[model samples]
Target chain A: MTTGSGGRTVPRERERPGLTPEESALVVRIGVFVKMRWLAIAGVLIASLIATQAFHIQFSLVPIYIICAVMTVYNFLFLYQARHLNVEASDSLPETLAVPLRHLLIIPRATSPLLARARATGNVHIIVDLAALTVLLHYTGGIENPFIFYFVFHVILAGILLHYRVAYLVATWAILTVLLLIGLEYYEVIPHVHLEGFAAAGLYQQGSYILSVLLALSTCLYASAYMVTSISGELRKRQREVVALQQKGLTEKTRELEEASEELTTLEEGRQHLLRFLAIASHDLKAPLSAVQSYIQLMLGGFSGELTDKQRQMLERSSIRITEQLELISDLLDISRIEGGQIVKEMEEMSLSQVVGDSVENVRAMATDKSIKLGTRMPASLPKLKASGVRLKQAITNLLVNAIKFTPENGEVLLRITEQSGDIYTEVLDTGVGIGAEDLPKIFDDFYRGSDREKAGSGLGLSIVKRVVEAHGGKIWAESPNPEDKKGRGSKFTFLLPKNLVIAGKKQGRKARLKSQET
Target chain B: MAYKILLVDDDPDIRDVVTMLLESKGYETVTACDGIECLAALRAEEPDLMIIDLLMPKMDGFAVLKELEDGRWSKYRNIPILILSSVREEASRRRYELETALEFNVDDYVEKPINPEVLLERVERLVNKNKKA
Candidate 1:
């Protein structure tokens, strides 16, 4: 069974067969013991009535009648409990009945409150009632009783349910019951009354009864011990099977998880490859388009000396279309690379001032065109930090260009560099559209744009910035400088890089160099 | 005196653009659609320099360079070859210097869609160097 994300059981596989056919057959025999309880109760009751009438059998009729009646009630209770108890409950009840049942068997004429209590309760009720029936049989025919083998049945049932020690105790008690009955008959302590017809017809009296009692007692002890040991062996075997099945289940689950993880990794790799292709394509495409745009712009601006108003307008519209197309291609490429994990970082010790200056130079022309105030503040105390120069420049330039694009004419965009304990920080503070609180978290997500921004952007700038920062073991976050600083109070984007860089060893560097050289 | 230049490309548009640009810059230009046509043109006219695109139909630029290196025609072997294409930087760099034999030397490499100013500068340098040699 699998638990879904909602935590409900979903069926995954079916239950397997637990017990063999031979073991199942033993379970059926346990059923026979239950059936025999009822039959024995009925037999005892009928025998008692017959003895009173047929042979004018003389005894305390009331005591015998009361004993038989109580036995019948006990038998009925045992049957009811055995039928109702679930498997685990039934197994526990049998152990509780063990000692008391042993007492009942040994002292055949005795009764105890504990035994009576046990009789009213559990599967042991059946065994206790069966002991009572055995005692009655002794009264009717002494050791000559044909029903004496019922002691073996009781012992076998005890062996199947109780522990081995309990089974041994029960077997000993059964043997003692036989000895007690024979001793009583021999000593005449209890009336040596036997069934008149059977005793008279039989030639041997004391010898035959003693021998039959001995045989029955021995059979009961042997059978009980054998059943206890064999059933325990079977139970242990079943337990082993359950353990093995559980282990198999765990191994299969682990294999499935591994397979799923491998498949996910392969899919991720494929996505990254596609993203790389798109990024390269878009970058390459931009080269030619830029050339076309510049040539057209130059032509329209009368570098060729003059142009009509209509021609100028047509040129402007074409430029707009070409610009839009370029933006769309770049946005598609940026978003794909971010999602595909194509952006790899190379960590090295780099100067913050150099990185800032390079980024400024890259977007300087655009800033000039916008007439935006671009300034940088770098402290001489700023320590060199571990970072990827290309990736950091790409991210910082995107932020700077975004600022230059959005800020009004004469608006200020400041690049600030600072150092804290073992960490270097860079902040781009732009006097452009500030982001809203609700849009802050999702600003770093692919293709997300804040509603407050006026310009149409591909919305991939922040996402790229976020990826590059994280790849360099850094963090990127945004905050508005003030609530009242709406139009001029631009968003401040900050990122931190670790001061100490971990460099790969000589061998790995050599391998990387070789691979790059081969390409 | 105008310099004679041979331009080779599988793409007709690129060839037309480069030829037009070179001609307008006051150089005499000759065009070939493939390496075979280039070889045939070389036999008819002795150009001062050759510009070849890396990717081409029927016979590629590398094969043409290999043919030139093998000295099928002794006079053509000494001409300075300039590779111009949009092939990846690392691959192009290796193709130009690392893999080729000593005789198969490329004078310069320019990525496409060619910057006219850079192209003109490289062309002039190669033509001047060849004339001196």
Candidate 2:
């Protein structure tokens, strides 16, 4: 396989199983031929009845009725044959794969088996029609009948439905049939029934009239064959071009979609690489910052030497700033890892209350440092959940730290764990300052401090918690003015973990994978 | 006599600060830059406690922990080990736990940038506990 202009590997041309455009056109024309013959049969019956009953034209009806009856029988047979071939053509082929058989006109024997059969059938029908018309014309008025021009119609049909050479051959056959009829009638070899009122008397007996009529009809038949064959040839060529253009358009669309999909895959890979870089960069960044903090702590602890109160206070402030910077880096690392989908790899089965308990204990010291009482209310026996316990604790700790940071001294912060409706809800509520109504909706947005930009922690705290909750197939929401608090001056942050946590992870992964495939 | 402690870290700044902190607390200290040097130091002379960083060049703290568990180092197995590093990632902790199939075998795990007083308290507790044993 070699890459095409589209940069997609192109396979070798396959042997498509279907009818060519020429064959399809032939099938359609054959059906039309059958339908037109039914009209011819009806015209014959109606005309003969009108001639005998209405016009009182004197002619024996026996031969005329016999020819009409024969036409009816074969027309039914042709209808069945056309239907059978039409079904075969349509059922075996997809329409898009059909293109005109360019060489079939010059080399009919090289055509498909189905096309060969259809061509043979069409040729036989034309020849049979010519023979039948000849007999009917001879019986009606020999060379005087106006319906003798019907020979031109069959020649034109042959041009439309058969190979060009075959159409010429049909024209010759029609001309010979006419000549034979006129010769027989002239030689009195066959009895020529006469239309006594319709034409001049003994018109069949005039040699000059017969020869002139024969020449006009021969020229008319040859001209019809030549013009119709050339026109149909040009039509087929144009159809071939249109079909090829359509195929080209379809291939181009497919190629564009494939290119777009490949681009999406590359973009996804790039995003993954960026996330990995972020994780590594943040980790690398945090290392030296932590070292600086350690040195500051050592000095603050009087290990380097005694320091002035002013120097001590300044060093303490620097240490706090370093700690904040380190915390920000850790948050960045957590966000990147969560976005990178590594959180799913760390899931473990543990109790919901156990995680909440650990989180509360983690933040209790901070609450005490601020003189804000931290209380937890958990059900005595809680069901277990499958989740990334570390991420869960981080989310809970962020919420607690946020509450403790915002609340005033002696303000109370409560963490309550409750099981409801197949979900484990961990709610953190504080009694100091409630979030504004405008800030509630955007609190979970990345870097959204919601009008509280002066907060001590990274603004990514709530957003990271949101990502963690969603990664576990859960939801988190914030409400101002804690409904559970009697004072109505605090905010409540609650996140619920569904009992079927692992299924959520799988579903998320599946959705992501499916979206990639679609692109 | 002051109890001797081995401090293993790749960063010289951290090693200097921690060494100063330990010495200020009246504890003698030795320093090694990586797990390989730490192992070599242990062979030369065992200390009462080992305070090591988890991430380092040449060899990491986990490899040192695994090597210390070997029967060849049985005599030093009783010496208390404290893990001190900026790498507070649960992944590393989980890896160590999964490999050992037990609780963290170290005497204590302390994340970096900790209060020096708390670090000293944990260090003294481990050393005194080993002494009592």
Question: Per-residue lDDT for A225-326 in model 1, tens only?
Answer: 786657765774685687678889999999999999999999977886785677458646765665565455555545445788998898788777777667
Model 2 chain A: which ten-residue window has the lowest total lDDT? A1-10
DockQ of each: 0.10, 0.53
Chain A TM-score for candidate 2 is 0.59
Best by DockQ: 2
- Kindly list the per-residue Cα lDDT of model 2 for residues A1-519, writing each as its tens digit: 000111111231211237666666666667667767877877887888898799887788888889888988988887887667644554233112122332434544634656766766776687678888988887788788878877888777767766777678777888888888988988889988888778888788898888888889889989988998898778868977887898899999999999999999998798779866874686579778888898888888888889999999999999989988888888888888888887887888755666787898988888889999898886555666678989999899999989998899999999988769768788998997889988888889877877776777778899999999999999999898988889788999999888786333322222445555665
TM-score of chain A, cand. 1:
0.45
Q: Which segments of candidate 1 are over 4 A away from where they belong?
A: A1-221, A276-324, A345-354, A368-374, A379-388, A406-412, A430-460, A470-474, A478-491, A497-519, B1-11, B27-115, B118-133
**Residue A44 deviation, candidate 2, in Å?**
20
Clashing pairs in 2: none
